[model samples]
Target: MPLKSTLAVPITDDPSLPVVTFRFWLISFFFTALGATVQQYYFFRSSSGTYSIFFVNLVSFSLGKAMARTLSERKFTLLGQTFSLNPGPFNIKEHALIGIAVSTGAGSAYAIDILSATDLFLGYRINALGSILLIITTQCCGYGMAGLLRRYLVYPAEMVWWSNLVQVVFYNTMHNTQDFQSIRLIRGWSRMKFFWIVTVTVFLYQFIPQWLAPILVYFDWLCWIRPFDMNFWAFFSSISGGGILSLSFDWTSIGGATMYLPLSAQLCSFAGVIVNYWIILPIMWMNNYMGVKAIGKPLTTKLFYEETGLPFNIKPFLNQDYSVNETLYEQGPPANMAPMYALGFMTSFMGLAACCTHVGFFHGREIWRNWKQAVGSDQEDIHTRMMRVYPEVPQLWYAGFYLVMAVLAAVACEFYVDLRYLLPGKPIANMTFKCYGYMAMSQCNLLLSDLKLGHYMKIPPRSMFVGQIWGTVVGCFFNYLTMILIINSQRDALDGTKPDANGLWTGQRVQTFWGSGLIYGALGPARMFALDGKYWFVYYGFLIGFLGPIVLWALSKKFPQYRWWSKLNVAIFAGGLHNFPNGYAMGILVSLITALVFQWFLFRYHKAWWTRYTFILSAALDAGAAFTGLIIFLFLGGGLSPKLAVNVPSWWGNYYTPEGDNGPYLAVDRCGAANNAWTSGAEL
Candidate 1:
């Protein structure tokens, strides 16, 4: 099914179609804002806020709408022919497609971290101006790079199939007056009916675990103790455990933990899992356990630890505090948690290495190609090709604008926090002009590089610029504040064990801030980027991220028999499985299955059900999950707190003994100096 033929709404011969109404923009912006916020909150639990979504979504959608409106009024020309027309009030296809694409790229795992980190370090606080810049910078940088590479990735047809295009085309055609009569079964009511039925069914199934299971069911089943046996029963029983089990089962069987994989490369990842779980984990466990006597230290050894109690093995430390045999319990569970860390670290390291190698190779080629082309080389490469096709305003102009804006941003951030020395000799002003000027300029340079990449890729320059600027501005402001709130709230969970000026203390800050940031950043990228890169080969991984759909074009040349493969690729990539494990593999599998099933249905039953609804249905399901997860964390996960403290009882024996209390205990003040000893003679 060629998208252009199947979903293209024939442009009307008449030029009297009305442009999109303000009402349409308003309604669409609300929904897009709601959806984006829900997705962000869930994906980046700590950083995103309910309100942040409103502003970010409003800006992106409104800007997008405005851009579309502007474009609708313009006349486009190509190859000496005028392509003049009015795109009515909502080219439902184009706007929605842009929204979905931006959501996928920006809504994934590390987006929150990226936004939050930039805000904290760069000092962009959450506000209207900052929000605008954040969104534009991040989105533009990523999309810009992606767009520039799209010719090499998506246009090749052999490189990427971009399946989501089908859905956009289908919806547009259905809504367009000129095309509504072409498909008898896909009238307005029928389309609504189909969507409603699928949406309800998916909602019920997905919601069961998301809402009910957390409260009613125990997640202990997921604990390491049950392991294989637990997963086996869970897999066969319900969808709840089935999803997780699928991941675990696939991890073990596929050995998905292997080192770097190359583009269009095929290799077994299952072997790596086996080595890590069967060999590496055990060895690390044994080493830690046997060496415990030498390394064994109480949780209260350090002030940070004593104040927080061991963050990971809290229960064990708690057990030691209450139990008669304190030493045994302290050493037991602590050993177990170490293995999970080891596994996580190994996977993260491998993934990072793969990313570095992949990005390095592609960037090197790009640099060399640009140099050669500039000096008049023998032939033009992809970069030269992109520059010729999508020439932009000069780099210097953008650079200058970026610097001016970045400085303003920094100044605003400093003033907002009352950190006036950021401007020198002033300690209590909202923001000095100098700080704003510096930060804005710095951020702009970064944003420009990202945009340049987008321009080269031929991604609509407007979309790239809008997305990046919005993401960067929004992220720079809210990320740090959110981090502080989350950290302070989780303080009790973090502190080892100590009394502060106000009594006891919890050290959740470490975990909430640094620990979680590092862990999430590592794992999030690993699961998505690491797995996807293998299909493209490490050397060509950057191309996969940017130009994934282009594979369809390349493949079509050799395997004309599998023309549908191109369509399949597009759908999977467009729908948001670009970086998932077995994403490429499952893409091939699903495409094959769908093709066979569709062929049978179309030929024997004469129905276009699969062709019409699969992509939409998948997107809806994913959106549901994203929203549900967001709600869960916001309402159910935990609330923010200002103070930090742990109230747990001491393990082993109390290091301190009151003046009146007795019985072979040592007395030490909060400062760790020995005040007294209960025993007359203590063996020193």
Candidate 2:
């Protein structure tokens, strides 16, 4: 089904509404600081949480209104321009600006991965100036790319960027004072009423799963049926096993962009999850294919030694300068990953290759037409026509910004570059290269999404540009500050010396990042993916990815009557499959169910209710879960004082008894015997 513009976003705008007001700057920075700190803090935890823009929109609306009621409207002249502290009213434009800034700053800076991985894993800390420069330049490069590509990605109506619609609906529900027709199914409640109701309800209920009874987060009840059975637990454990028919009551697990992304896309992703987790991983583990029995579990994110079941030792492989000791590395046993981890890596390769071909096949002609049309002359809809009143950002500004950022990025990267190998084995240098090279492309996608939001809201391009710059700069500093504090305070827990009793400081995120540094930096791809290596087949994923979309495109063209063929997005399917390998397997299943209920069922049968309340419901639930998680972290989970020492009473539901080889986080799957080889029943 095609997306209806009137249902998803507003078709009209008010030029009289004040934007870039005092309300925008204050709320934007305050939340930026708070969001960056909280997001960075949660980055190390096993059940990581995101401080989303929906939370900012809900809280900032109140703050903006409070300012409007209290602040004096006295006009003042500054630099030959008149400005007022208070605007006429708290308008949607200011609200949109605040949301944009919060969204920009809320994400943990990508460079922090480099900092944490190097400092914790390699015992090498990057200097402060270099770190800051790396963060800023990497982020700014994306801004420039977004500005350059806005014509095709942001301006086209077909490029819906589905998740942004939730934010748009939330803004309209909050600011648009007109009452909507009440649905009897929801007990005659308006959108605003429903938003507050859902927010407060979810906020109160989140305590049960987040802290009181944490076991509900991954309610793998099937594991409880035969807790002593290794194969049974291996088949159904939501924490470490295949997670077949697992359930989760945790909102953080169930209530993300799942409620908003297109249902077809979610189904495509679910198909990937089914193939990888249920079929491929199980067959490999059960059959012990490719010496899989030596790797212990069928699914994990950790790398292991084939000779021993213990985690792989990368330290001995490194030389004084952190380069791979080729002779010593060659003599040692190859590091092996669980079949699931290896398959996930293949999916990542496939998704990357598939994305290129998918976009070219689906959108090549439209993009070419958009490129040929001049910037000011490519108006297609009423939104574009109304936007013509505001001056567009000049192309030269983006070109100059890209040039400056590119130079700064190179300079910062050079600070660590040794005058040795072309691609040095220095993990820090490897990370820096990855951040500037790969992360910049992701950043462009992110900024292009934000620019689409701006286009939808009819915001002036200049104001959106300034707000993004301000938010990004503010976020980078705070993210760095928080990372420093955590590393200093919880070094022992983060470095694997001491286990966090509450499971809050596992450093799993950095561990994953550091693992990549070892693979690509210390142990170059030549050795890791050699023709004779166990992972030689992984490279085939690239060919599979490239060909999958082309096949789908051909089928779609051949069977024009079959609309479903066109909707099956191969890139989305591959990306979705990769997400389920970790603890998110159950969550992805739950998310697909939720998408079916809202995006498909209600959307088809209850159009009025779906249009008015679906996005509101998503935003409210996210805000509630986030706010509760923040409180639990601060009060019960050791955010404020380390000595506070609060914990939930141990019971059958929340019990965690550490046995052999189960990773951090409690689960009912206590099958220590599964750690041994299935064939010989002996510890490898």
Candidate 3:
């Protein structure tokens, strides 16, 4: 079935209402400020988790409604049209735009953490303004790319992003009432009523695991069964590498992601996890093949160097200016990459491979057709035709936008030449090329996702471009501040090996981020993984990624009933194993279960109900969990003086007392103190 949509009707049927009001901007800024505070708080926690602005909707919507009533309806002429200062009433479009602003204001930029870790842990000095500008440019680079390709990317109807469908459904539901006409939805109920019921129930029940009994986050019964034997307890560990099928009772972290993904997509990722981590890596380690005996940890590059008794020595490779000395590095003794590290590095190649092949296989024809129509000015998409009333933005406009961001990016690199290796846009020898590979992997997905967002919400391309580019600028400032605070306050915890007094700050994710900057930025992939290098076999991952999609595409076309196989997500195969020094596998498991129960069963059994209730239920669950988590963090203290700690009884299940800060019993990867040969650098 051809996907169809119309924009003849306004999103709220009230465009004349005020949107750029004092109330809208104020609420958005407040939310952004709150998000910054939350980021700072979460950064110091022992657990590796992030908080999203799920609950902001409730506050913003309420305030927006109140402002709509209180503010006056004074008329003003902007150009030819009359506009109201009060806007007859606040609409969902206003709410969504504000939400987008808030999200952008507190958004994460990759460069912020990259610079933070490099400066704090790696002993590099990055200028404050340089760091900020770098973030702005890289973040905007993706948007400019998105704009250049908007004709193909955004104009198409099938570019529906599963993740963003929740927002689209919510907007129409709140403003438009056609869907609610006399239809008994899932469970022979009304969607409006059901959403409220679920929302309230979720909001209440979220207090249990988050506030009272935190141990339910990791309900590892295996540890309780054999408290005396360290080995038995270690087998079920969730944090370290040995999470071998551990259960997480926390619904927010676990099942929250599945609300968007269908069952087959979830299963594909789960299968990849099981096959790669559960079956392959363990087997290799058990045999001690490929120097697995020397592997220090899972999901790390630095540990590989440490394990080989030849940790990276940055002194020999750094110029007098503290920049990487390209000549010396190319000739220097190559760092020996542990097999485990090489295995993880292999995924990047697959990610790159999949980006090209996946697009070619699925949306190639439609994209081509869209391009022709857009250029020829015939049979433009319905969305594009509707948008013709507004002056069409020229491609040159996007080109100029790209130049402005590019110049800023280059200037930042020049200003902080010492940290130039971290700048992918810079024209450095191997560093820029290597960084571009990672950028392509990310930007392709970003452009596609942004297109879907615009298509779903009917946002104009020019407006979308402007928002994304500048929204990035707004986000980078807060993100930079958050990074600086986290780094300076918790220096030792920046690498997660050292446990703080409160056991709150863990640098697990930073370790991963810093490690990548160290390798790809400082050492360069040519020295680490190219021919004659230690990790040559890692290059084959690209072939695997490229071939996987081709094979899957062929199979699906030949035998469409077995189409589930075609849905084998290449992104999962490419990037899934690379994620978790944080150990999100428990979350992945819970996500799969939710997809099976909610998306597969319910969606198949009751179609209209599934359409109506799925997104609302998801939104409700996310909002509930996020709200509770925020409250607990702000009100309830941590470590010894935990707020509201007295509510729960002090038992094994309630309070997890550890001989070591981590592990139910032992570290999952069987790693211990590196006192023996931790700093043994290269045989230079």
Best by TM-score: 2
Candidate 1's error at 533, in angstroms? 32
lDDT of 2 at 288: 71
Question: Which runs of model 1 end up more than 4 angstroms from their true locations?
Answer: 1-28, 44-89, 92-192, 204-207, 215-283, 286-346, 355-397, 408-513, 516-613, 629-684
lDDT leader: 2
lDDT of 3 by residue, 149-185 (tens): 6666566553335556656665565556655445565
Q: Supply candidate 1's per-residue lDDT for 377.
A: 42
Per-candidate TM equals: 0.44, 0.86, 0.78
lDDT of 1 by residue, 187-229 (tens): 5445434444554564455444333322111122222233223
Query: What ranking emerges by lDDT with the best candidate at the front?
Result: 2, 3, 1
Ordered from best to worst TM-score, the candidate numbers read: 2, 3, 1
TM-score, prediction 1 = 0.44
Instruction: Show the lowest summed lDDT stretch of 10 residues, model 1.
Output: 251-260
Clashes of each: 110, 0, 5
Quick one: how many clashes does candidate 2 have?
A: 0
User: Cα lDDT for residue 423, model 2?
Assistant: 70
